[model samples]
Target: MPLSQSEVLAGLAEIVNDETGISADAVALEKSFVDDLDIDSISMMTIVVNAEDKFGVKIPDEEVKNLITVGDAVNFIVGAQG
Candidate 1:
C-alpha cells in the first residue's frame, strides 16, 4: 500500500529534526526547504538520502530540484510510492 501524506510528512519531519536541530512542529507543507528551513545544499542532499531510505522510493537528482517546499517532497513521495 502507498503511504499517506501524513506518514510522509511525519517521516520527513523526523529526518529533518534528526539532521537539523529544527523542531518538527515548524515543518509545514507551505514551508520552503531553503528559505524557511535554512537547509543548505549539503543538508538537502542528506535529507534526500534519508528520505529515500525511509520511504523506499527513488528520488532522482532531477526530481530533487523541483522539491522546493515540504509539500512538494510529500507529494513526490506519495506519487512515487503509489
Candidate 2:
C-alpha cells in the first residue's frame, strides 16, 4: 500500500535524524534539506538512499537535485508509490 504524506514525512524525519542527528520533530515539510537543516551533499545523498530503501522507491541521481525540501521528497515518494 502507498504511504500518506505524514507517514512519509515521519519516516524521512527518522532517517534524517539517524543520519545527521537532527531531531525528527524539526524536519517539517517547508524546511530545506540544505539551507534549513544544514545538510551537506553527502548527508543528503545518504538520506536519499536510506529513504529509497525505507520507502521502497527508486530516486534517480538526476532527480535528486529536484528534491530540495522535505515536502518535495515526500511528494516524490508518494507519487512514485502510486
Candidate 3:
C-alpha cells in the first residue's frame, strides 16, 4: 500500500529525532528544519537519505534543496509514492 502523508510525517519525526536528538513532537508540518529543528545541511541530507531508505523513495539531489520544512519533505515523499 502507498504511504499516507501522516505516515510519512510520523516516520520523518522519528528520523529527525534519531538524527538530531530533538523531540519528535517538535517535528510538526509547518516546522522549518533549520530554524525549528536545528537541522544543518549535513543532517538534512542524512534525513533525506534515511527517508529514502525508509519510504522507498528517491529524493533527487536538486530537489533536496527545496525541502526546507518537515511538511515539504512529507509532501515530496508522498508525491513520489504516487
Candidate 4:
C-alpha cells in the first residue's frame, strides 16, 4: 500500500527534526521551514537527503526549491512513490 498523507508528513517531520535539531512538535502541517522553522539552505538540503533516503525516492535538484512547506514535501513524496 502507498503511504498516506499523514504518514508522509510524519516522515517529513522526522527528517526535518533529525537534520535541524528541531523537535517534531515544533513543526506543523502548515508550517514553512524558512518563515516558521528558520531553516537555512543547508538544512533544507539535509531534509531533501533525509526524505530521499527515507522514502526511497530521488528528488531532482531542480525541484528542490519547490518544496517550501510540509504539504509540499508530502505531495512530492506521494507523487514520486506512485
What's the C-alpha lDDT at position 4 in model 1? 94
For candidate 4, lDDT tens digit of each residue in 1-82?
A: 7798888888888888888888988767788879889999998988898888889899998998888887787888988995
Which one is best on lDDT?
2
Q: How do the residues 1-82 of candidate 3 rate in per-residue lDDT, one tens digit apiece?
A: 9888898899999999999999999999999998887889998999899999999999999998898888999999999984
Least accurate stretch of 10 residues (summed lDDT) in model 4?
24-33
RMSD of each: 0.7, 0.7, 0.8, 1.1
Write model 1 residue lDDT over 43-67, tens digit each, in one string: 9999999999999999999999999
**lDDT (0 to 1) per candidate:** 0.94, 0.95, 0.91, 0.85
What TM-score would every model get versus the actual structure? 0.96, 0.97, 0.95, 0.90
**TM-score: model 1 vs. ground truth:** 0.96
lDDT per residue for candidate 2 within 5-80, as digits (tens), equals: 9999999999999999999999999999999999999999999999989999999999999999999999999999
Clashing pairs in 3: none
Q: Which candidate comes out best when scored by TM-score?
A: 2
- Model 1 lDDT vs. the true structure? 0.94
Candidate 3 residues lying further than 4 Å off, grouped into runs, are none
